[model samples]
Target: MEPDNAERDPLPKTPDPLADWLEEPGSTAPGRSSWLPILAIVVCVALLSGAAYALVKLRKHPAPGSGLTAGQTALASPGSAWARDFPVSTKADLDGVCRGWYYPQSPAATGPAPHPITVTVLDNAFKMRLQPLSVHVPDGVKKQFRDAWQPADLAKVQIVACVDLVGSGKPLGKCSFTSPKVTTVPFVEGIYQITAYEVATGRKLTEARVIGAEECPLVALVPADDVLHSEVSDRQLYDKLHALVER
Candidate 1:
């Protein structure tokens, strides 16, 4: 009889909507949204992407003193070759062959067979002169010397003679010269041999000759050689000579 009261009214039981939704497979739950998980995934992906980009940027532009960007150092030439081995004899030797002088001991497999010749230039006194045989001089470069000599300081100057050789292993021929009024001369197109002479005596400043060769045909006005040896251009030969001189 007492138990019948239970069935009279289960004291106004409240329906739990969240519990009901959870029980249903497809129903949405309270305070639980699908967008939160989607947003979290998107945020994680963005963070990873940002980190990847940072690593790439750091690799491209590294800090200074980093050995990664450093270049190679130059070494001294072996003193076996004639040009590199022989000490410049005199000022006259420097003037005649120091500028636009080239000689290869072995024939280049790529360019034409070099036209070996002996080059010599005598001073006004004719007492001192440059004697460098087997030196190389481009065909059209002689004109550069002529044009350059037309100026006030170089007008009276004379190239005298030039020698060219095929392959010398190292640099070309050794040169010498004598000019009282000459400080620098455009021997071959863009190639210039600067001679710092004593202001009063008009002699060369440093006995250490400075030889510079340029292979820029368009800019230097030096022409390429089409000899019977190889296809090696004057530019290539010039570059080789430049490398040797710089060293």
Candidate 2:
């Protein structure tokens, strides 16, 4: 009796419901949802899609020379060619004619030599360089020259002669002077020898003359007489000299 009941095996104690649910392969608890794995998968896919879109956009807008965009190619071609084609000249002509010679005004007056003058022709103007001889051509004188030259703007004239005795070969105690005697003159539009003389002895080494006009602005000195004369169109000469000097 008591024996039989004890033998019945105290009714197999039922496992805890929560423990059974946890142990089961498939089970849904009160506050738990079954969509966690699916949500995780969706999040992963969304991240991957964003990453792929960014990569595609980056490929389309890559840096220059990346070989993908045409911008780099366009910049490389004609721009480079144009730079290669046109150049500038730096070294000026410095021959004896280009570099001036000296003459004595008075046969009795003896000295080393007068200042060596140089002239440069630019597209819009000409420059005169007189060294070793100091000629204080007053602003009034310059203005007079400009007026005489006529129809040219005198204000733009830039005269820059300095006294560098060490460089001068003249015996007149070496005084250097630079004067932008005239500017914007129709006659002086290009390179020309306006005047060459020794103020010390009043000797004239070269005469004043213009070789080129505004229509054609290139001047080259005649080898024999040092006379100014037009050689070619300024643009053509500029292009040629630009190429040569640039090289």
Candidate 3:
């Protein structure tokens, strides 16, 4: 008594075309490959971010003697940072008021090989009061001599450094001078340092013959042999001077 339609098996069910396409082997649906694109994008972003961070760090911490010395103070040297060591040292003369490597022991300078920089004086105490005088570096080797010197009120004054590329070792000492009102000079391009020390008066330095007569200090603009200067020319001293100035 079953109806023919009921008895007959339902016509083979038609497959959904969409379903067949989705279920088909080796078929690429829209979202199947989404993860790959996302992962690749993430990896590229990470690499770019890392490179950017590294570049920032390099700009923040420039190499020593660059625009900034190890101390973070700007350098007077025109180009990049540089340093040298002097093995031989000059003798300190006690006969005068003050003493140090004030003269270039080498020959005369025809050109500015070892540049002259003017170093301002500061008090030795932590107060670091300014001194009336400054140390002058000449482009040549001549030591300057004057007839008389005015007494500088400075005692136990902070030391200043003139870096000599050809000079070796730390300076043995510093000398003082008196000029009418040479409180400061417009900044010039060169290397410099400031160490601490106690020395007498300007007159003594002049009398001691520590400041060379009007002659160049080195053999040439630079020195051929071991010449004199100070260990203060090194990086540490460069940093200290900058700190003192900034503070």
- How well does candidate 1 match the true structure in TM-score terms? 0.18
Q: Is candidate 1 or candidate 3 better by lDDT?
A: 1
How many clashes (backbone atoms < 3 Å, residues ≥3 apart in a chain or on different chains) does model 2 have? 8
Using lDDT as the measure, the top candidate is: 1
Which pairs, if any, clash in model 2? 158-180, 159-179, 159-180, 160-178, 161-177, 161-178, 162-176, 163-176
Cα lDDT tens digits, model 2, 1-247, are: 3445655556568756466335455765555544565789999999999998975553332232322223321221221111111111112211111222111111211233212222233321133433211222224433433232121222221111111111111121211223333222122123343433221122333343333332423332222322222322333322222221112
Q: Which digits, one per residue and each the tens of the lDDT, describe model 3 over residues 53-94? A: 975553332233223223332222322222211111211221
Residues 1-247, model 1: lDDT tens digits: 3555755755787866456435565565555663566789999999999998975553231123322221110111222112211222343433433342211111111223121212243322233544433334345654433232222322122222222222312233222223443222223221222222211111222221123343322221112331111122334333333221211
After superposition, candidate 3 runs with Cα above 4 Å error: 1-30, 62-140, 144-247
Please provide TM-scores, in order, for all candidate models, with all chains considered together. Answer: 0.18, 0.17, 0.20
- Residue 104, model 3: Cα distance from true site in angstroms: 27
Q: How many backbone clashes does candidate 3 have?
A: 29
What CA RMSD would candidate 2 show? Answer: 27.3
